[model samples]
Target chain A: MVETDMNSQAKADRKAGETVLVADDIKRHYEIPQGAFGKPRILKAVDGASFTLQRGQTLAVVGESGCGKSTLARVVTMIEPASGGSLRIGKTDVVNASRSQLAALRSKVQIVFQNPYGSLNPRQKIGAALEEPLLVNTNLSKKQREAKARAMMAEVGLRPEHYDRYPHMFSGGQRQRIAIARALMLDPSILVLDEPTSALDVSIQAQVLNLLRDIQKRYNLAYLFISHDLSVVRYIADEVMVMYLGHPVEQGSRDAIFASPQHPYTKALLSATPVADPEGKRERIVLTGELPSPIAPPPGCTFHPRCPMAADICKRLVPPVQRVCGTTSWCHRPWEAETESAA
Target chain B: MSLLEFTNLSVEFETLNGGFRAVDNVSLTVDPGEVVAIVGESGSGKSVSMLAVMGLLPWTAKVTADRLTFQGRDMLSMRPKEKRKIIGKDISMIFQEPTTSLNPCFTVGYQIIETLKKHTDLSRAERKNRAIELLRLVGIPAPERRVTAFPHQLSGGMNQRVMIAMAIACDPKLLIADEPTTALDVTIQAQILELLIKIKEENDMGLVLITHDMGVVAETADRVIVQYAGQQVEQQDVKGLFRDPHHPYTAALLAALPERATGDQLPSIPGVVPGQFDRPAGCLFSPRCSFVFDRCHKEQPTQAGKELGCALCHTPLVAGKPQNEAA
Candidate 1:
């Protein structure tokens, strides 16, 4: 079974820079019932997010809470179907995928959640937990499953003695490693990491991030990294998608996004993130007013209410996508000065 | 006189596995209008020390200090009645997890007013008016309607603002904010931090910021205390600490930050923090320290001189090199 799996993986690796996942204006909406008499109000958790994730690269979705980064993760991983738009995982269309196609897609795409404590079952031993995925998905024998699980444990830096230990016995970082090992049980091509290190300490987070980078290189896996942490995003992400109130306000390469943010929202977000260097010159654009309720989000470009450079037109009309310095920003007045671009 | 001071403070909690020393020997002093940040990972006892000062710890915990004073008044030996008078009135605290810290049974206004009623001699009308003003001061829009709103009605940021307002109701001389922005979004965190600083400046209050984020410590703290497994690993001014960390643990922690990474892989510290049972016999950080030696594993080191950022290491780092190592 392992040999067959390797052959299939080698066959799939024929093309370099293969696009593993392509999300075209994927959206997820939740309708809240307003009593028996009133109409149901629509909550646009994820409005229109479009991006393509390549093999052996990371595309990070960054936003504050309620900005639908998690919702987008669910959509991409096919855990929750998008209310609109399309998602293609290598050639399989997610919108109309049959049972067998979905089963195949599930093995190809796996997710590691934020809270390792809640994600794992306390009663389940590490070995059994890792093998359960194989038990359900593949026809491998029990011994073969145990061998694969043990190999994965070693790959993730877990000790051989820790195989029979319960989840409760392991620390947070160790549990997260277990979670990552479980996600890789089927040798997924695309991994969805939704705030994977947010719950961890800085030191532990570093270890996990290094592990992720190592695993990504070894497996040549494409990663859909979802997080609100810009610093972490700046480190791991090849491309960045900045979301605001379920809208992709800015989308560009990591350098372009970090060095020269075109959108005002992106600029505010960058400035708001406190730099580790105290001597670093930072022009803080402290945005006033909290995020507007997504249920009754302001008309036009939902960010107009809090935008420092907001004009009359900005409040009345949604801004069209403007491309500048290899970055796309949905704003009426994007910083287009060529001098601001990074060398 | 210093706004707050702690000399050789220690906190031990009575757990199932005997006495667990949550906070080791920690010495700190905070002047009025100073921001002192206690930075460490979870189980590092950054919060416990501050909680010891606030007298908020459970009865099972034993708190000891050679000198624990607030404005020259010894807090360690103060009577319960006297301590209560000074706690909410002079030295207030904003707890972590605003959602859980706030009482769901009462309105935000009622809560703020309750604090005022306990600390001040204000009338009912004046208390209500003060509550609204406090809400408005914290950047909560439509303060009039928000005062009547319950904790559930407000967002996490707004609830945090309310918590701040409650803490500063009586204009505390020393404010202890324990992981205030941990539960908040970055934008909201920025706002809350700005608000705290603004409040601290206006009131000339000594602020004790207990958090783990290096970015936050760099941006906000005047002085920083780096804790590792209940021990004061290092203490220095924010700028110097970031520029030249004198402790290996401090250096490793700062290097572990993603923003500070020079390459693809971050220089991470190996192994988790020593828990109650698995604690090392000598140095608490020795097992994980990159420059660990046989001496470090055998004998616990005392705090180094001020030149070394008061690092609790025998071979304190000087310009990233161990000072006591033989060539």
Candidate 2:
């Protein structure tokens, strides 16, 4: 059976530590036709974003709605091709991977969407849903595939008896667990989790988080966790990337980013996040105005318009990326603020 | 004097599955110039209770209350016309999704003008000017330009501000914001909350905030009402609620927060909130509660005292009676 070989291979894979993914200045821009006679406008959904993912680690990309984090995730998951720059997963060049290589890439990299119910087919049984990935990616026979599906179900903490049940029979958290199980069916090295727990309740969210953490530890999988919830990021992310209007404002280890965020935007984000403690009084920095539209983003520092400490130079020239205290922060006045106290 | 008061208010919806009680004998009061936050998760009846108060629930819903009063006027006994007069004039509401709440066909300025026209007798030019003034008051940049823009043209935060502007167009005495900032970004949420606080203080209006986020409740609410399975679990001043929660559900909810988790495993409530059909005969939260015992599964327990904070548990988890008596 493939189970014995697969189990040993997984163990070996865990032992071999390696860089799983490297994304360099990846850009995903879309052109939309304005009207019948109007010129097409370019919407830079993701403009010049880069990050690295290592096995057994999670790199979280945190941003608001228009900040291009989701776009970046889509690009990584190969749902859409990047407009420019390079994306390499292990040895495969993501942009130009051949047909066979693309299939291999699909097996190596999988994605879990925000809504589990939407991701899974309504009519498909839980067993068939988990088996579909194996059938597409591998040449496993009927009996072998069924066994693998059952094993995967138990691995995700679902009963093997639940294999024949439909998705609607399960609760939201259970459905998400099935989604995670399906993603792990191919034994993918990288999992692009896009707001996996956002739709779930808080208690359920904690359960899913614990599950993901356990899965990462067991499989030595690299996770590209994309979420807008900072508290979740603080709990799960090894490294964090803060995005503003389709650009990276700050990226570093979770400790450095949370403890001592250099960019004013990062500081404001941290300050704006309401703490659960009612007695704790933290300086709440409320940024005025809304997130600038990605269609015609502000020149120079994209955050300059809403930035409180914006100077003349900030508007005129783009801020250079400077490494300070083990973090890469892009800002004009990085030294204006000090590190914040830990929660 | 209380601006809004609900005594033994219960709301039930008639479905094929029978009457599903959403708000069960929940009593609370909101005074003028006070911000009362109703905190609960989905299906906890926080929003439903507020909707019942607004008289906005569907026709299928059966609402019954002992004393549903607003500014000493009996809301339950009042004629439909009289109730309609006060609603959207003296009492206005801003929903969670600002985009959906505001009419997409009309411009924001037009909506504000419509609200002003319905409630107040302002002249054409005066209404237009007041609409622009309301936009400026909510801190929209270039109110002159934004007033003409449609809801879709504006960002989520801007639309929310526009909603706030429209909600206060009649200079409403009470504003019911149901998860007003839930749809916005954190920074944008902070701005909206600050704006709500500012407006509530300046206008001297009672604000009823319904939200699921304890952080927002902690930051903005003057008093907190914790709901569980359509019943009031605990009610206290915002500070006292956080300092020492009386109910296990409230304590567990606070503990479940990612920040409060001192260990790797968060103290999560094991089961989900039971549906109306499957609700246990005793305490509704007994299924998920950690300290559930025999009595918790047998008979429902009532609140301890009228003035002091109390929990709906057989053995009330009293965190020393809250000194501040709610007026």
Candidate 3:
């Protein structure tokens, strides 16, 4: 795998293409069966979220648990159809695509789940698991698919001899590598990774992150990385979108979000995340109260209950989305904190 | 005097194959009103050592210690009843999964009151009032309503708060919290840690926080203990530990954090923590240590300081040198 080297050529080729995935006001909600009392409640899993992922770059979706980030990924990956809005891959409209079109779109966008062990069939060998995608997606013969699987295994830093091994035989990190290899087997233009390395140890986590970086560079694949870890997001994401209770509260570049977060929820999240450096100390903003249930969300600004600077206006009126300091933040008081800090 | 002290403490479990030593010669002390953190990866014996102290090990395990004392009282030699008096009263414990640790069938108030009843002489109504007060102390809103709620009725963070209320019911002198906030969200974790620190300070309690996250240790711990492969490799003040880690393992661990990453790639330790059967004959970390030499393979090194802070290496990193020089 190390024998073949492509420097800037693949990156330049990737940039030559247009946006890989464009999601415009996508929504995914579920109807829950309440006690035979009143109308059924609607669980707004992914409510009116929109973002565009460029080629050769990563767009990270971050939030606490139950924030609808994973649901957005599911919608993009076509695991579940979006209830509203449009999703496009290149020029293909995935939201309202037909059966054969979706079959083709499957090779364009793929997903890697959080638990690698659960994603892969324990009974299947690594070679067979990797080849299954090729068999279903392409018209390649069995021998050709086997050769490609061995090459893909080697490309992911695994030996060809280990291709015959079962899923249980590999470690957590190795299994994740296999999962990544399987996702890339069809050469998908877009990859949605959901908490890929959260299960591995720190040392092993580093290895997997580096491996992902190398694979990204080689393939120049557009990644929709979903994680709750800000530190990892800071390292991997070119752009970030902060979601809260099925709403995208803030979206900006990595530097903009990390250096100067405008939204109160974004600020709270950044401060609450403890820095690994012991010598590095910063004042933390601890949010009070639990996340409101998505089934029955609060009116107006959803974060007003736990927001530190929440005013009377915040509770009564929905904050309008405004561009502030290179970031689009939905807040009642936008960039006021930044101006004060500057003064 | 220290509130709790353990010297040369070791714990081993007898499996079907053979004996597996979970903890090895770990010496640590906790002074009153201080937060001492034990940091390590999985199977590093951080949890096992604390479990040994709490006498919560399974029947297959064997515990040994030259000195184990709490408030000048010998814990290892104490009678069964005496140990019981101190275990839940003066020295309480909290675990990672509060949902599992708490009894789901019983109300939160009942559990807190039971702890109070076992340790203090109070009327039933007084115990109930104290339970409500404890819930308020742990920052649970609407304590009166929450006190009667079952474990399933509350969220993960609220259940953890209830667990804390029960632990501090007896006003324990020492609280051993094992990964108390590991299962909660970051915001919730910050709240829980702040509550723990506030309670520890107000009551002058010594807290032993067992966690693997360096960020949590740096933020909450006054002193830090670094363990690897069931042995205590390094111990230092929080500032000192971050500024100049003595052991190669500690330095590597800090470097491995994604937040501390500098270049395009991270400096990962090459291998995972060795299992019991695959451990090296000499230094436990020699296989993964980048600074390992021929001597490190043949013999184990000991801590040079008067206290038990050993790197177990011949050519350990000096105070001023860069931590990732070997990398």
Candidate 4:
């Protein structure tokens, strides 16, 4: 009985040690003036977005260009300050961290940007770019850093000789690999990969995705992946968050979202994504009208202006985040599981 | 006879390193009201080949072609002003980025009105009337209000519709859409592509769509030209190309696509496109070709390479050409 108790305690402690990225009611806002010397308008970017990124899992934040997905990522990654809500990175208060404190916070997370060329220096060699993080953060010797850089390159499926070559010499996919290697330099437990393979070709996209999956398995790292590409998000993400205007309208497990999405915005987004097959028939939820300006976002429900099922109440009151078919959505009319099954 | 024809055309861009041939000796034809998709990966020379036909090639670009005729006019022999007359008025072109393509300083309505003024001899009132009509035709509601909005103010999809509104402002004979929907989301892309096709059918205008998307080609194109390393690898009907692509490069493109079909393994081509300086002596595709034979390596082949494999036009084929013989 004592032996069994001891084993259970060890398992519990180990489970406790495993970090889960929790964003509790995260909010960020920017002040924009209405007129010259007039009252400042509080432009809420992300208003109370809450989710958790468990260890060895990916949580995709998907939305249109100005939907505050990038802002959420930026605020969560400590690149920008959050206005309200607390960020617990394995019990560490990331939202309140100072520059040096954030620098120490760097040991936990890293980011791989969207533009492969923009993220990587044009003049710098791949090896040097990969070695930069190690040199900055650690007391590792020059030789040790070089060795780590080369190994990281191989981990990302780039050749060792590519170390000498610059970013310009490599293809879009190859350049992305270099960027991934650079991000891995800190041995970061969490990676906020922002549209990592968006610029790459289809075949190269597959290769890079496979590499990411392999690395995730090896390192057991958490990912806060941001992408507008649905197919890629479906492939890599364990849980998905759909953002609209400045709020997370829908979020659930990958299977739950794909097999049966509850939110109308999520449904519309899925419909918007062009399936590759020429013969494949997708019932398109054609969303008409432009995404309203962030400065003057629509009252109550942001998507009401273009939503197919918007009612009078939908435009008047903000819908509660109610559970529908096990998926949570800030929508008045989430598709019920029984209705989905019937359909 | 076809509206546009290319015979043994090759384009070379002179760089500091050397004269790099961006488009090899190629031949293609576009009939009146026909939609021809030129599909290939980046650096495949599909866009460059079309650019050559438009006489848009610069002074540094050495264009060697036996014949590049447009409606019986020798494009290669045309003067500067004569080409300019045909470029926007008779042959309008739409670029990928509608945001960047539309000038930010001016309103979309004014820009489109300017296009009408440049191409046609209409009064100020007549031009405004036509501009509003064009905007409406492209499915923009309340176009009068939208006309005043600058490119930055409009959404990406809306801006693209405005660009189409401008491109078709003068009712050109042939529309060159170079990846017009590449930057757009799927639903918006569908709308734009459908609108373009509808306009083409309505006006009976020839279309030259240059894109890397096979899905777009399969859905819209009647026929297609598969390009690789500045050369025509395969030319077939859309059905034929998608059903049974001939050239290895063409096959790779189709295979590279991830379909909605339930399949665990997605087809992927192993190697990357070779650099300009490092192009192989023989077939540009030979290094990556799965079924490369002896002749594919030894002889530097061009347009004629496509002729040999062509099922429609069997041999006696050209010296280097292989056509779509694959079943």
Candidate 5:
């Protein structure tokens, strides 16, 4: 019976190249009111970001803190509506969708937070936590929900006996496993993983990464992987989008971005990340100064104050999007231009 | 003489279930102008051993050591007042969380001045100037204005800079930074690490860096010590330890890095670290070790010679293979 279920699920898998999510000029802004006498100020958290995700592929969004990566995740999962632009998920126009339509769309996209210890309810048992989604979303009976939750637990490497245990009884790694299991219970097509392994040990991180990859392959799921660790992004991301202060500075294939980073910020980010190899000798380009305040970002380019090769034009005007060697960059003087001139 | 010498240090905490050894037989030495790193996962007791050195552990912790000295001065037998004089003056520490480590109620300048008042004879005017100078040395822009700002007013990186300024306010001879940059971003981490190394060199201070990041270890450390389950498993120079780790746990941990992976599947070590109750009688890592033998499950292993990284294993690995298996 289990073998037939596996065969049927394999047959039911979606086409590998189908586009599951598309975002165009997505923006999430917050307006802070400064007392009733003063004017309201608009803070652009995520501004003019666009990307597409296909089945069985991972598109990682990499940035430092307060860069709006988490805000982007919230917008994509329909937890909050975007302030502007369009988002289309599997032919459903999410921006203009009705309430009933949104209720159905929410289940199609699921998110796993960074900290497992906080995300789970302490008083709730593992079985109830897994079944809560099915109960609220579907009309499945108690017996059916229990069967499905147990299957998911087994799939995520939890034992049958662990079904009755509380979350505090589990270790960090096991808690993360349970979190992943809970996210997968809805059979979502898109998964937004926000620093899923940042709080875990290296050994446990490897295990979770392997499990994510396996689940992605098995279900042909689209993954919007978000992380600040560039090494983990380099390993898991098929395409990488580098964001700085609410702007997409660079976007390209993983190999292209890692090998020949055109944007100054991207180069600095790659260099700042310390490689584990002691023998590998590479020039380090440490960017000076912290991220500028997003509320009142730099006049022109958000990264001009920290760019190593910033020209006078960079400080006066925003750089237009330019494509070079299969990578898109927002920079006035990309390294490729200098290299090409030298050549 | 070494700047700091710690021999056979152990810390056992009294819990409801009796005694739990958090640090077992850990020995470390630091000469001036050297950086030694203690690398381990959480609960590996890397921070506890350093806390024990500073006499900062709680009263419930039972600390025992054969010899704990600093620059030929005995630290273990010193009175509380004498130890206090040396701890914050000659030996300072920077904690992992910069925001929480600082007092939120006071201005950053006041915090730095407080440190100076305790350890230096400078007058009020001179101490204020010194505080601004220290902040400038740590690369904080407009130090004059930043000194007046409270801890909650500055960013995380800025607060960390303030913390560094306070830690180095007295010109300490030895600095113990416990995961100082773990709470920071990569770009900020780079800035903080560069600032730390610069300060260490300028002061000629011995530095002890406790972290779980192998990348940071490779970039900064002169010597590396790998700890597991409160025990020191291997000790070697930074290059040698990364290139050819002699302990199975160390090898597996290096393999687990995402940057070191060659394929999709990382060669992860199986199972979790042993707790107090579930700790094995023999090798603490035997349950998760790949090359475990029958003897490993029965008897504890002793430390090997220096060539083998002083690995705590009966069959220490050499170039990824067991050395005693061939014999």
Candidate 6:
């Protein structure tokens, strides 16, 4: 059984292309029922969102809470199936794979959730929790899984003595390390991190992010890092995708997004971030009115309601990326010698 | 004298695990209209410290302080009636989640009106007018009609604004906002912080902002108090703390934060936060501090000096070295 799992992983590694994950126009909608029985309105949590994760690169998807960032991560990791659109991982089309095929795909991508306290089962020992993934994915003997789980625990910077401790015994940062180990039990090529260190302390947050970066470089892994923290995103993301109401408002390299953003929403978000620099003098743009509900987003562009540069056309049509500047060129205005526009 | 002074404040709670000190011997002072941010991690006692000052802790909790004098009044031994009178009327509070803090059964107007009516002998029409004025003051639009709306009808940001409006209904001298904008979006959080700063200045109200984000302190705080593991590691003016943090913990904290402008990749502190079970006798930050020497492990450093030199520093001051050197 151990031999079979090893052989499969080896073959899978070879078969897997450099681009580990591809999410094409992914849509994850849920029918949230209102009232007794009338028509149940659909919530397009991931409304036609699309991005790709290449080997050794971090694709940070950032947005405010309730902007469907977690929903997008769930779909990318295949925890919750997409309502529409396609998701391909390592040349394998997983959007509609069979039961066995999906199971195989699960081993290829794994997710590290937000709360370390909630993710691990308190009933199970640290060793047992880490062993569960190996037990499910590989046809390994109990003893083999136990040994592998111990090694994986060590891989995440946990001591071997911590194997028998309960989840409550560890600090938030250590528990996050344990969660990372559990996710790596199957040696996944892609990791979908959903605010993995949000619950940890600032000093500890740095350690966890550093550990993730080290691991990513060591394994040549693709990361779909989802977080609302702009500072964290700036640190780890190679490329960034800004989402508003489940739609990709901007997609570009990290340097591009931080240096000069074209989207007004992105600009506001960047300006809104609180920096420790006493010298930072970027004028903050406080958008009037609340973020429109995802259930029934504003027509035309999702950001038109809050955009300072909003024009008549912005309120009538959805904005699409027309070019790439620093990150992926994202803009609603036409690209030419210079098409004058805002919003 | 400061507008509000808290000296040697400590909070303890009993649990199945045993008695744990939620807040250590912490001391701070908020001058009139100054924003003093108490910042640290989840269990850093920032929230508990402020709650103890407000006398809002549950029955299970115990509080002790050598001095908790607000405007020269003994806060620790004040009569329940006296404390109650001062709390809403002179020193109001705000929490992180507004929905839970706000009474959902009543309109925002009623909540503010209750606060007003409890303290002032005002008529219903006057209270309603004041409520509308407050709602508008906190950046909530169309406050005249919105005051009648329930808390559920408002957005998170607006609800927070309503919460702030209710807090400042009586023009409290001291405003204690505990993680007030932690749950809000970044843009909303910025606006709320800005509003807090504006209101503090306009009203000349002393502000105590408790949060985990160091960046928030750097942006909004006139003074900064950094707590860790229920102990105050450092306290200084915001400029001094940012420019030349005396404590190594404060330095590490400043270093840990990722700067959007600085080209340097963020440098994370090593190791995890210490749990209650493993809190050693010495400095709470010794395990994470990069420059820890013999004294940090062997002997605990006391809160050294009274004002400008209050932090526990291992490195001796070098002769002729500049004082306000940037890290």
Best by lDDT: 5
Question: Tens-digit lDDT track for model 6 on B260-327?
Answer: 32543456777655655778767777887776766677777766664544775545122313233332
Model 4 CA lDDT for position B289: 70
Scored against the true structure, residue A119 in model 3 reaches a CA lDDT of: 93
- Tens digits of lDDT, candidate 5, B1-327: 999998999999999999999999999999999999999988899999999999999999999999999999999889999999999899999998989999999999999999999999999999999999999999999999999999999989999899889999999999999999988899999999999999899889999999999999999999999999999999999999999999999999999999999987888888898988899989998999999998889999999999999999989999999988643
- Worst lDDT run of 10 residues, candidate 1 chain A, spans A334-343
Better of 1 and 5 by lDDT: 5
DockQ (CA atoms), all models: 0.88, 0.60, 0.68, 0.33, 0.83, 0.58
Q: Write the number of the candidate with greater DockQ, choosing between 5 and 6.
A: 5
**True-vs-predicted CA distance for residue B311, candidate 6, Å:** 1.0
> Candidate 4: which docking quality band?
acceptable
List the candidate 6 regions with Cα displacement exceeding 4 Å. A1-17, A32-40, A333-343, B12-19, B59-62, B103-110, B141-154, B260-266, B272-277, B305-308, B314-327
lDDT of 2 by residue, A3-51 (tens): 8796878768664347989999999999989999999999999989999
Looking at model 2 chain A, report the run of 10 residues with the lowest lDDT sum.
A334-343
Which docking category, incorrect, acceptable, medium or high, applies to candidate 2? medium
lDDT of each: 0.92, 0.88, 0.88, 0.79, 0.93, 0.82
Clashes of each: 0, 0, 1, 14, 0, 6
Calculate each model's fnat, 2 decimals.
Answer: 0.88, 0.56, 0.65, 0.18, 0.72, 0.68
Off by over 4 Å in 1: A1-15, A337-343
Predicted candidate 6 versus true structure: per-residue lDDT over A1-343, tens digit per residue:
6655874676456432377777888999999888897789998898988788887889999998778899988888788999999888877788768898888888888999999999999999999999998877778889888888887877789999999999998888999999999888887888999999888878788888878988887677889999888989988888999988888888888988888776778888988888885545678888777778888888898888888877788888776666656554344652331335332
Tens digits of per-residue lDDT for model 3 on A94-141?
A: 877899999988887988888987999999999999999998888878
Model 4 per-residue lDDT at A256: 90
Worst 10 residues of 5 chain A by lDDT: A2-11
Docking class of 5: high
TM-score of each: 0.97, 0.94, 0.93, 0.88, 0.98, 0.91
Off by over 4 Å in 3: A1-17, A139-141, A337-343, B306-309, B319-327
Clashing pairs in 2: none
